[model samples]
Target: MNKTVFITGASSGIGRAAAQLFLQQGWNVAATMRTPDKEKVLTGANLKLLQLDVTDSNSIEAAIREAIVHFGQIDVLINNAGYGSVGIFEAFTPEQIHRQFDTNVFGLMNVTAQMLPHFRKNKRGTIINVASIGGKVTFPLYSLYHSSKWAVEGFSESLHYELRNLGIKVKIVEPGVIKTDFYSRSQDMINDENLEEYQHYLKTVFNNTQSSGTNGESPEVVAKAIYKAATDGSKKLRYPVGSPANWLLPLRKLLPESWFFAIVRSNVEKGL
Candidate 1:
């Protein structure tokens, strides 16, 4: 590939899939992960592994420089690093929320800030932000995670408007639940052992996430969407990946607030 792409969280999940896709298409990929050595799957001449933690500013700066040095200049940047911490709102601590935002929201800002000089100098760049349908709507027990995604949505959209006159482009890929380790690795907002206050809601959210996760779409579905949004040269746009997101987003908007929240409450309250 003639273009070089910088992808965060390139070790796993959607980030890994997108990186692999880009590399397979002949693009140079600077894949950074918190534990780059553990990324046994993403190895090749076109790939450069870098150790990066979104929470670490030094790591972000170093990775940006390394990516520019390795690839000449960053044609595209995929902000894909983040984790989900789902649980009842009342059960979440301030620290937990900070950790979530640091990685998902501010971490992304830091990376973008560091890469601006490169993009500005070239006057050409594409930024693809991996947001979620939760960015537009909410689900039970996912307040913190969804909130972060909403921030991503707002930030990316605003940047799209701001940077459009420039040579930069911004797009958001809003995927519905996907079959990723996110569910398995997701932190329990309230641990089952010690968290007894919101037992009912916790059970509801856990059961719902598990049930929905099973039938969710594949990572490739999202990979294809990300590829299009990044390379298509389209202006700021939101591509809702997966049938559920495409269908649900319109429905959620058409429905009244009470109806939507009631439906969410009903579905979540079930099998609790």
Candidate 2:
């Protein structure tokens, strides 16, 4: 029997790419997004679209129930529905902070928690949490986004040990700067009434983000990594995709704290 894969954020970018790739591999795909109908790439009798929003429990629950009803058993899940919260840390109000976590950290867990019963019953499944290189290293003006990804990394790691005996696996995909709508979709909080004082750092960070977003690898690169994690049946904990992401893993470990910070500060903050 062909395995069924459920993916979030299927309307665009990496999630969209993954859906296409899995479909090509002859796997059953449950592609969910805020607007699934907008996806022109998803086709075939095996494709099912679920209207899903990770931050909305009701939406997520409905999607899960639908998946269970249709596919009977979900073999893999790609938690990819999230946007970047970019700006100075001081500029992020409590509401803004909550919004960041609500979508990125808590939202991912919410979906995973809802699906665990399904995974546990079968004693087999893969949860591909879309974390980032930011999870491992800090970047200026991305405190909220990076912190959320860091939480994901930690969450996925601990879950691996907890579920391994159950024959389920949890993996993290630490993608580097992929050429996607990630930057264009960031919620900027630089000059909100609550955080007007952090304009200097915010400007520098925003500029850096714009430049980097344009130069990153295609979203397909990360999607391929996610596909591998979903099907490779490896015991490895994390997979870093893309050059910048793979490079960061060692750099963060080998570089001196002061030196690394200096480089980050100069490249990411000095001009601001």
Candidate 3:
């Protein structure tokens, strides 16, 4: 029997790409999104489109239950439903901060919690968390986004130790700058005109960040990495994908704190 992978945020980008690739590779796909009705791309006998709001526990439960019912078992769970909240940290309202953590951190934990019992029973499974290279490093104007991803990185690392004993694996896919809706449709930019001091810095950094995203690799690159993590059958934890991430992650580790911070600041402050 072929394995089934349940993916969140499957309407587009990395999630959609992963779903398509898995189906093409002869695996069952439970492609989930907030508005499944609007999705027209993923369709096949082996694909099941379901509605899932990662921030909502009821929705998470319903989606997981439905997926298991349809596919009999889920061999992999991809926690990919998240958006970026960018801009001045002080400009962000409490609600924005809460929502950022809600979707990116708490929501991911909730989904993983729901899958644990099932995976434990089966004694074999893979949990792939779609994090960002930002999780390991930082960029300007993305404090909130970076913090949330950092939380994911820490959480996944700690969880891996416990899950390994249960015959379940935890994998983190960190993509540097994949050309995806994350830079637009899914990005939340916080701005305050009253904060005149940050305007110049924000503009310079935001422009640099946007340029990187525009020139980034396709989401398919990250999807391939996700596929490898799921099927590699190794205890490997972190799979960094895309161009700069392949270099930056190692560079960050090799360089001193001052050196790395200076490099990041210089890159984002090019126009300043």
Candidate 4:
């Protein structure tokens, strides 16, 4: 029997790529998104396009149940539904902050909670979280986005220890700057007319960020890394994808904290 992988945010980018990759490898894919009706690319045998909004518990439950009913079981759960909330921290409203955490942090936990009983009963499963290199290292104008991803990184790390005893695995896939719709459709920008002081700074940093994605790897690269984490069968935890992440994660660890921050500040703030 082939395994099944349930993925969120499968309408585009890494999630869509992963769904296609898994289906190619003979796995059933529950490719879920808020607007499944709009997705047209991924289709074929063993593919189930589902409607799932991670921020809504009822939607999450319905999608999971439907996938299990259709495919019998889901061997892997990929938490990939999230967006970036970028700009000056001061520009963000309380509601925006809540929405960011709702979709990125609590929303991830919501899906995981819904799937845990199924995974526990099976005694074998994998949870691959699609985090960002920003989780480990931060840049300018993405404080809220970084907060959510950083939460994901820590949560996955701590959960791995407990899940191991249940014969389940938890993994993190950190992509540096994949060429995806992240800056366009998959991101939200803070807008506060009162915060004119930060507009120029935000524009500079946002431009630098866009340049990184323009030169970054394709979404398929991170999709492949996610696939490896699911099938590697090892206790490995973090799988960093893309160029700068491959170098930056290690560099951040090797260099002093202040020095690393300085380098990041220079690159992002000064566009160096």
Best by lDDT: 3
Q: Compared with the true structure, what per-residue lDDT tens digits does model 2 show for residues 1-272? A: 88999999988888889999999899999999987767687788888999988889999999999988997889999999888877666656799899889999999999999999999999899999999998999887778888899999999999989999998988899999898878776444445545657666577677876787889999889989998998787888889998688777898899999988887777766576
lDDT of each: 0.86, 0.86, 0.95, 0.92
Worst lDDT window (10 residues) for model 4? 263-272
* lDDT score, candidate 1, position 21: 92
Error of 1 at 83 (Å): 1.0
Residue 136 in candidate 3 has what lDDT? Answer: 96
Q: Top TM-score: which candidate number? A: 3
TM-score of each: 0.95, 0.94, 0.99, 0.97
The residue pairs that clash in candidate 4, if any, are: none
Clashing pairs in 1: 1-26, 1-27
Q: What TM-score, to 2 decimals, does candidate 3 have?
A: 0.99
Q: Least lDDT summed over 10 consecutive residues: which range in candidate 3? A: 203-212
**All candidates in order of TM-score, best leading:** 3, 4, 1, 2
lDDT of 3 by residue, 1-272 (tens): 98999999999999999999999999999999999999989988999999999998999999999999999999999999999999999999999999999999999999999999999999999999999999999988888999999999999999999989999999999998989999998999889989999999988889988988899999999999999999998899999999899999999999999999999888989979
Q: Model 4: residues >4 Å from true position, as ranges?
A: none
Looking at candidate 2, the ten consecutive residues that score lowest on lDDT are: 185-194
Backbone clash pairs in model 1 (N, Cα, C under 3 Å; residues 3+ apart or in different chains), count: 2
| Residue-level error in angstroms, candidate 2, position 201 | 3.1
Give the Å shift of residue 21 in candidate 1. Answer: 0.5
Q: How well does candidate 1 score on lDDT at residue 260?
A: 86
